[model samples]
Target: MEPPSTCPPDLDGPTIDIVVADPGWHRLIPNAGTIVRRAAHAAGMEGTIVLSSNRVVRGLNGRHRGKNKPTNVLTYEHPAPEIILALGVVRAEAAAQGRRPAHHLAHLVVHGALHLNGEDHDHPGDARRMEMAESRILHRIGVPNPWKRA
Candidate 1:
């Protein structure tokens, strides 16, 4: 297993940002953030990893993507000026899925962090690489392969 990257004086590893105004967002922010931050750390990203959720599904749908009463998870990730790993999780969907909010949160966190680290699944080959990487990362951290369960 790759060792967690060290934080150099000139480099920062993922910073967390919480932007969800909805009071109903997950209480386990730290839990999810820790999982994602560690994963990003393992991936060798030298930046801040922000953790947050969203509520304006309409605006998100129009700006970010999709408009189907929101989604269980969404991540807006990019490099430069610090990476924004926005995680928007629909609380109702989590409840409907009978998942512990924390699990869903952890999954989204890893997913977003991976994106910031340049991992993508836009195509079959890319997806396979991402899923395989995610599976290995999640497994190492004791979380089941999220895609495998889904």
Candidate 2:
């Protein structure tokens, strides 16, 4: 898909190179790159987001995070900034939260982009700040706050 001509001017949007490794997910998310780019722009970051399957994300989580489990999203920042979103986890979380899958995906993209930009939740104070930033970014894009209780 082509990039949007009118992105927010305050931030230099990222060149989001997206790779949809899952055919089913490709069909599920039509404009995945656009979503990633907008989220990155909101976070004032530049990166890549790979919309992948559960297995690929699980392997990445295990190798990188040492969790040995599938996760909704993973961010890498050393070699290059990149975010990986697992379709399976995203879909499930969205459903559980009664939110549209696309909205949840966008939230995760923003969360991952923030991580790429040095935002972390390792401590309570840092996590609160990160969550506030995520909420603000998502709100700017008209997405509901993901942290709000149901």
Candidate 3:
């Protein structure tokens, strides 16, 4: 998802704040705080977080599309004067995909942070770049490569 250009160009703070929300599937996920903080740090962002847990029936991956049902992970950005990362994840979706919710959440947080910095994946090339970057970052933290391209 693209960052919403709601942030004004001028703000007093030189730091970007991180806001995290639990998307309502605690049953499937854990260690949300550490995951979110790690993402913010990986993206070179510093600040407060105002995150929320959400319920997403529509799968953002569209992997199953009109067939299998929604899968985990969604990124929303409120761009600007003070950047905000709106990271959403479907805990159930993660479980259904055989993914750990914490891992999925971390991926989305990083993805959301990238959007705030103008990274996009609408095209194959862009997605590849994003995936590679994600793979590298996750690797640094001892997480397996998250990129399907690899």
Candidate 4:
């Protein structure tokens, strides 16, 4: 169940490069690059996505965000705009939140792309707007509302 190397033909949007460093999680997410590309197109952004392990994400968090913990996703703008996803954190969070891994991954990709597009959730209003946009994009992709209570 290796992830697809290329995006779907219909997804004619921004280019995305998905580098999966964790082989175990690779089977869990098929067509991950397509998902990220769709989200980026929906959010009107162009970037890359790195699908990695929790350890890598944790290290990045400690160095960049100063949080010193693994997060589901992180978006960075320097060197090159890109989104880094921690598969372990994403799987755990999705299970806890009762979301399918694919759906949860879609949500995170959309969230990261939004951040790359300058959408921030640091404030209540901004958060609301970003969430709404995420919902809309997810809906368009046929994924259920990730924020909806299970």
Q: Highest lDDT: which candidate?
A: 4
- Residue pairs in collision within model 2: none
lDDT per residue for candidate 4 within 44-118, as digits (tens), equals 767677888899999999998899999999999888888888988999998988788988998998899888888
lDDT of 3 by residue, 75-115 (tens): 44444323222234345545666766677666666666666
Candidates' TM-scores? Answer: 0.59, 0.85, 0.60, 0.87
Model 4 spans > 4 angstroms off? 1-11
Q: Rank the candidates by lDDT, best first.
A: 4, 2, 1, 3
lDDT of all predictions: 0.53, 0.80, 0.52, 0.81
How much does candidate 3 score in TM-score?
0.60
Which candidate number has the best TM-score?
4
Looking at model 1, how many pairs of residues clash? 10
lDDT of 3: 0.52
Candidate numbers sorted by TM-score from highest down: 4, 2, 3, 1
Residue 19 accuracy (lDDT) in model 2: 67
Clash count for each candidate, listed in order shown: 10, 0, 11, 0
Looking at model 2, which ten-residue stretch has the lowest summed lDDT? 2-11
| Candidate 2 lDDT | 0.80
Tens digits of per-residue lDDT for model 2 on 17-128? Answer: 6666676665666665567677777777775677778998899989988988999998888788888889899989999999988789889988888888788999999999
